[model samples]
Target: MPGFPRRLTSRAAAGLALLPALTILLVAHLGSTSWTIWISLTSSRMLPNSNFVGLRQYETLLNNDRWLVSAQNLAVFGTLMVVGSLLVGLLLAIAIDQRLRVENTLRSIFLYPFSMSFVVTGLAWQWMLNPTHGIQKLVRGWGFETFQFDWIVRQETVIYTLVFAGIWHAAGLVMAIMLAGLRGIDEEIWKASRVDGIPAWRTYVSIVIPMLGASFATAGILLSASVVRLYDLAVAMTNGGPGLASEVPAKFVMDHLFERGNLGLAAAAATSMLVTVVSIAAPLLYARSRARTAETRR
Candidate 1:
């Protein structure tokens, strides 16, 4: 009984400290999500209402050509962006892990882009990819008249350009994460691999990569979240132009909500995105948790 008052006081203080976060989670996040889901099922347009249309908006969304194009573009962008960023970042991390003389400088330079906003990255890439004054023009000026690098203005290739920008912006963050993971590996592992006549590349591919599962998962989740909310870069770079070639789900939702005044459609799109993210994330999270539990037991 003597320690009960102190324990009670400590518990009360901890709960009190968590009150604001709990309020925000319940009201700001869960409440907003519930309301959005409700609105998506309605016939509301330009404003919220109690119309209760029952999945009509989602049906329309599926049938819409622009929405379909946007969805397809998102798949392309997300796949290429995530893969490219991971590959490029891993290579960079591996290079730096070799104890180069300019490791710090290289890291700062690589990470500098990630520090800049996506808006800035988009604008920079846009300028660099512009046909009139960008790479094509510059190359033409260098006597390469027939060299064409104008992917941004072409419908089929505009999404790829966005992927390039996304990778450039995200690769550094992934590199940093992987570098930390690499540094955490035991020196004995490297020595053992060398003693067993394993090539350095083989060691990295077989042993080191498997050991950096946590780092890879962390970077992947972050990249996937960015993919789901990919709006600013698309807006700043192409503005979903080139005949909606670069349009993504988030941009489509925004255009419907604000520009088109279609609240129901916007909410439906947003809900679909949420569901997709949750579905992908749920399995990964469950597997990770189970792995951790198994490790603890072992």
Candidate 2:
């Protein structure tokens, strides 16, 4: 072959080497997603079948009380998890960065929860939050007769319990993110702020936080994704609770997909979730892109 044709062949071989990863991505992710979209438009029963029914499944999904509640619960849970984790994680990181002793041990203690599967951790949290046997019992044993940490058992407050466990499980990851961001800052910044007579708290609030915007954004996105897919924790903790109080979208999808034998409805719910995620994520991505373009221009 001529030189140009040989060069083309070499480039084609390099591209072919990526085929395995591309195939996995398409098959495992995009393929399944496309199938789900197709199935959502059909009247599939326990297993998917080829009976097209247009938007009936979506209409039914829209009218579903459980699905509606799950959406609301996800909104509340997502907000709490993302904001609470960020604040608590930033505080933990700041405190640990204060030249304290045993910092590594403390960091490990905080981070170890992130390493464990939420299945076990969620169950452990459930046990700890159990009304008759856990915190209430232990505290009551200490002679406080009216201590009520029984929110976990209440329909109105069970979602908050999920938030608590979620924060516990996820804040460590946030802490690690923020801590890494903090460490990357120049030591001169801290010294200059100190020399300028700025209080450490003000310095952190005004100067450090702005500098750590990328870190906060990263942690927030991670937490938001976790919140969207918050099934395992809810299942292990409340099992959709005292009359569907803690129902979330992922659990709703799973229930319909398996137990209810309504793949169409499940697919509709999944599509709704995807839409919601895109709706929320699109603006953030657009803003980030614009910011990058402006920075590059500057």
Best of the candidates, TM-score: 1
lDDT, residue 114, model 1: 92
Supply the global lDDT for candidate 1. 0.95
For model 2, the superposed segments whose C-alpha errors exceed 4 Å read 1-13
- Which 10-residue window in model 2 sums to the lowest lDDT? 1-10
Candidate 1 residues 1-298, lDDT tens each?
7999999999999999999999999999999999999999999999899999898999999999999999999999999999999999999999999999999999999998999999999999999999999999999999999999989999989999999999999999999999999999999999999999999999999999999988998999899889988999999999999988889999999999999999999999999988988998899899999999999999
Deviation (Å) of 76 in candidate 1: 0.7
Q: TM-scores of all models? A: 0.97, 0.94
In model 1, which range of ten residues has the least summed lDDT?
276-285
Tens digits of lDDT, candidate 2, 21-129:
9999999899999999999999998989979999999999989999899999998998888999999999999999897989999999999999988888889999999
List of clashing residue pairs for candidate 2: none
State how far residue 34 of model 1 sits from its true place (Å): 0.3
Model 1 alpha-carbon drift over 4 Å, by segment: none
